[model samples]
Target chain A: MKTTNKIITNINQVSVDQVGIGDRVSRITARSVKNEAKIQGLKMALNMIDLTTLEGADTVNKVKQLCYKGMHLHDAYPDLPTVAAICVYPNFVGLAKEQLKGSGINVASVATAFPSGNSSLEVKITDTKMALDAGADEVDMVISRGKFHQGEYNYVFDEIAKIKETCGKNVRLKTILETGELGSLDNVRKASDIAMYAGSDFIKTSTGKISPAATLPVTLVMLEAIKDYYYETGIQIGMKPAGGISNSKLALHYLMLVKETLGDKWLTNQWFRFGASSLANDILMQLEKQRTGNYQSKDYFSKD
Target chain B: MYIGGKFPRTESGRYFTLKNAKGEEIANMCKGSRKDFRNAVVEARKAFEPWSNKTAYNRSQILYRIAEMLEGRKAQFIDELMQMGSTKKQADEEVFTSIDRLIYYAGWADKYQQISSSVNPVSGAFFNFTVLEPTGVVTAIAPEENGLIGLVSVIAPIIVSGNSCIVLASESKALCSVSFAEVINSSDVPGGVINILTGNAEELIPHFSTHMDVNSMLYCGDDKKSIQLIKENSAINLKRIVIKKDIDWMKDEAESPYFITKFTEVKTTWHPIEKIGASGSGY
Candidate 1:
């Protein structure tokens, strides 16, 4: 039976006077703490994308399997595990789109120059169009690192805006502000503002191409930008810290910054997502460890 | 949730663009302000009379209703939390803590008086006694972190004591706080018993602290400026100020007892036991 006030009265009668106030406090604290600990196990979930670091045709099947793995495992764990989206080049968008058909998880394609933003605007737009036409729900577009570094921020902004305008509300635009190239927190903040002003749907930390692309500070800066912008405009932008988010504890910390910085309204797939090749299984392993207090199968995860 | 008949969060969510780890757009949060905070206080003050005057048994039921709403919407709370960028685990904790705070407070409405006070020995002949009472309108500046629980911890304590509070909530985490207010509405807190403001605290604190009519102010924030403002505004009318130190709120401390001390007043009435009879018997 659900406990009633009568039950509470009975509970109150339980020789609490014999229990020191400290002990009662500790006892109550433990229950909440245990709940909090269990919650930790569930929250650090990630969408793992094992970038084979491959090119073109070789990427399709691997992408398909990763999507399949995500879908199937998600069927088991439901909300427990995030099906890391299929991260791939523009050409394989069709394959991933077809293979992962009907799977609610994202088919995120790398566009706007992919790993490098060295391409012409025409080529970048075409790549993004192809990916969108291929059923990519999210477009992870790399911003022009050279142009941004050279401080041609407006150009980068225009390009991202064009991409966003082209994606036209159907596809979410994740503008990658390669932090390795952005140089500092201020730049990260500036780039984040530019991307939002330019109409980018989400501001991602890296294209996972550059070294030191996704650091805690960079992500923190980006999240702060999203938060500040939303506070200013009544619009909430998503935050994704791709690459190097390999540890569950780190992921949890990221969640902390996001939670505390943004508030609970932004805590969802729509507001928060992580992009990494290795974070999912690690988080899964940790969650399993938390559940049973023993290590479980890491092999179950599709090698990210 | 509901404040002054309308649901509101503490922050005036000015910043838009909810980004994901990959940087995506999520949803919109309000840009709350100090005016809103003060307005909430106004509502709480208005709501205080009937609510405070309600028998303790009724207050307990209303608080219990809040606990029920919190429990019922737990999942939505979790989902909203995720979008706010909390991991599933962290989201779960936020939800659990929120619900627990309500349930914890619900238990205190009827029992706090039993905990913090005892009969005072009187030198006079009449029945002299003391009891705690509500401090009317109050203002609270919640902590920057632990969005849901922290907000709950402040608002619940203030209202449980029958004082309505205008609170400034964590701006970033206003979603749950917003939604939690709906829970309060459903739970039966009279309109204005708790009002929340969400935005730059600097902008909002001065108004609430210095408001001439405010009866008390709670300083729950870490910034020194908030303290200075609390001091400055409180001086205008000498509002009873409570500067809550940052302690491990994770532990219960059974602090319901403290609320009794905060809101109650001692009453002593004197009556002589010996004299009258003998005067008539002087014959």
Candidate 2:
């Protein structure tokens, strides 16, 4: 399924063996990170977090508190770095920007009928514009899973290109595949290639609203796609694995995967980020535990 | 059987048989391993903050509900105790006292703070006072004798003050502990708040004593070597260790507010006081 055209191509060329992917992920997880390397990995994971709060019950006060948490982390542990970004709904983008000013933390907003992407293309373009106009440093847009499922790869690619145009050059564009709903690892690999080829600065795994949100194997498939895209176009795409990553250990595994798959270029927050809310606190607790030589409790840490 | 809120057989799939007076195997109970104790400690740690943060009134209501549930299941408990070689009168008395002991601690839940706290007479212009707080997660070894009454006495005080516990039931008389776990399950007590494991104390106590996450240890047996082991290993984390022996739990003197205070930590606070109009103020 080769294409002579420059823009769209066949995703069927990307194939994944289900059993082999599982076996590789299991081996990756079994390799434990310990001692000095473990501490560094934990701190590095903490810095790459995109602290997020996307809920229907979200309020202005909650977003503001989350912004504060992004900068402060934990007062007891001094010299700790703040997270990479604070993610929120598009409507709260302006408020988060105002609250997080001068903190060097990016304000990321989820757009394009996020999580479902069931809205029309016109609505999705308007959603992207709303977020960008409100000073969002980054825009996370969801791909139309319905169109992709219906074998409308051309439509999916066109919509992503259109959204990238709406985001312009200043704001980073992240195309979420919502891999949990994609059914198979083979589909996840295809979606990653489609999003990256259609002009996305980042290819994210999920919207944090789906079960089996970001498994190791799914992320591995996306990482391999990013690596292959870099090889073909000499352009590096970022990766963010959102949801079900509530602890420090899993976050470390993700860093290991990114480093091994995409090399040292994607090791920093510029190319890799965790779209997680609770993962920050867990990392903070671990850092504190390492410093004090004792196990820390959630009571000592602040709730975001 | 209660590991993480649900009743499950031991992960090791090993059970110990209980013999009656005639040496007949009457029951088979789970012989929990180090893994089971570790799991219970994890659950206890998870349930600590939510259970400890509950208002005293709410905790009291839950304790009273347990007492109510125990009263309703009195016949089953008596029958189990009788099968464990307790005479009918002894079984009846144990069941009766266990209910009253729960009631006793239920009354103490809200009032223990008042009786235990105090405002200090400081020399400086500062208002200083001390209040008691739950000691996080605690692990207990239930007495081998008086299975019904002893289990209640050890658990009622620890939970009355809002601390969660992982109790290792008696090896010889283990039937009644599982029944109490059922009573706890139906009484609105949160899962993981009171985990009961039926196993040999010698096999499971070291894990309880050495676990870095557990904050306190409560042992009720008379085993000197096990107590020494608990003391030696608990030094790693400096856990608060309380060892009891030869105390008949069915006796009236066994129930006291001191037992509740034993599982609590006194936290003191100092607040600056502003002097007003040169009048001496007493708090």
Candidate 3:
């Protein structure tokens, strides 16, 4: 109830218990309008990416080439590289499901108190079930970093347990620690332990909301945690360092980190994933050079 | 001016160094002078036909797309501003304002002809009409205080109405201005419609303001001696001079007159609409 005023007035933190002046309302109005355009652009951009092939062309001609090449690859490589699943909010689980049918790729949707994970158990569990029922094969859920910081380790562990229980057979659970806010390598390691011990199929690095998500050091710490957990429990947890990675060199660096840290089992698309807006093209750019034996212009593949 | 994706820089690659706010050399900008300005004017003079002949709505669409591109690269602009030593808040505001300026010009491109009075009453049977037209190529000295926004404010208005400009970059900060030129070049803004330069205003502006071929001179310099030189130089060609103190484009829509006054070439076509009565009556 207090937040309505702050959201309406936009005076710093909405959660604060202070009365904001009318002057602040303009700031709020301006911010909301600004956010509207950005949100629309992001939604449209995401919808246009054909994630099944991860073959994006910057121009119309590139699109044609990609189309022909995709078909040829489909026919020839019959067992070609599988793209990571399409990620979306719970509402779009069905949409991802519909678009990716008979395509052998998985559909991943964030559920169970995503980003913040600041909600009741009933709500989180219900959200995960809905995503799975709507045909999400991989459900990425965020852990409550706030609770974890507040020494509510058991509470965080219980939430992941409920999600893992709900995931059942065909579905997998990715418990996100949001390491950016979680603070240090030690915090990341502990959070990784909690998620794996409670039976997460994978441990994710962020909600893509925080500033410091998915750094190599943070990810490296997480991989070490995953390896240690595997040595003790024999249950291998997957890793997805999603957010802000814009190219292939960074992805390759992350790949190198994973292979060195966890060894061969983590190399497959089943275990390793990079979440980003520009990472696909960077990967494809590398693939192009490898396939064609020449380096292309930085703008050769559209950065769009 | 070639009207394509590529705009030829002035024939002279001659340029001057631009400093950041900290007085460090950032870039050597393409320093165009009054001579280069005259050349750009000549190019724009040649280009005025096909560009102005196009429908207003089409011009407006092109301007709007320029705004979109600016919006997409707002972060990049801010980063450049930071490189040129502006704070984050100031950089962000300048970038956003630059984009808004494009939107402002976009709204005016089609409707600029309608916003003023054109009716004239004559005592005789002869009819007279007054419509705004481009004066010719504009010779502008862009403001130095607000880096990118001020630069766009001065340049966009002049070009939106089909006039072209020879804009001197800011004395210290020129990265954003040159970056803007790159954006305009990519946006298909007809070459010579905007020619950017970075150099000593005193050395370059004399030739620019005094050039007989240039139709006008826009001064951002408020100092008395500089103003005198600009005014004195204009005496040679009678260039329409818009002084700094006179224009406060920050508060209002400022693109219309800046352009209409510089680019429009007025020429009336006359034909006899009357026919001799009962002559050639085939009925």
| Top model number, DockQ | 2
Which sequence of candidate numbers ranks them by TM-score, best first? 2, 1, 3
Question: Considering summed lDDT, which 10 consecutive residues are worst modelled in model 3 chain B?
Answer: B1-10
State each model's CA lDDT, in order: 0.68, 0.89, 0.66
- lDDT (tens digit, per residue) of candidate 3 on B237-262: 56788786555545464545545444
The candidate with the higher DockQ, 1 or 2, is 2
Predict model 3's lDDT versus the native: 0.66
lDDT per residue for candidate 3 within A1-304, as digits (tens), equals 2432322233122121113322232233333112344333222222222232122223434333433332233232223343556666776667656655676656787887676788898998898988988888888888988888887777777778878889985688888899889766667777887788778888989877789867777777778778877897787888888777765545555655666678878877677776665555555544543444333223344443
lDDT of 2 by residue, A137-252 (tens): 99999999988889788889889889999998888999999999999988898888888888899999899898989889999999988888899989989999998899888998
Interface RMSD of each: 26.6, 4.4, 20.2
Candidate 3 residues lying further than 4 Å off, grouped into runs, are: A1-82, A289-304, B1-283
Residues forming the 10-long window of minimal summed lDDT in candidate 2 chain A? A1-10
All DockQ scores: 0.01, 0.15, 0.03
TM-scores vs. true structure, each candidate: 0.44, 0.71, 0.43
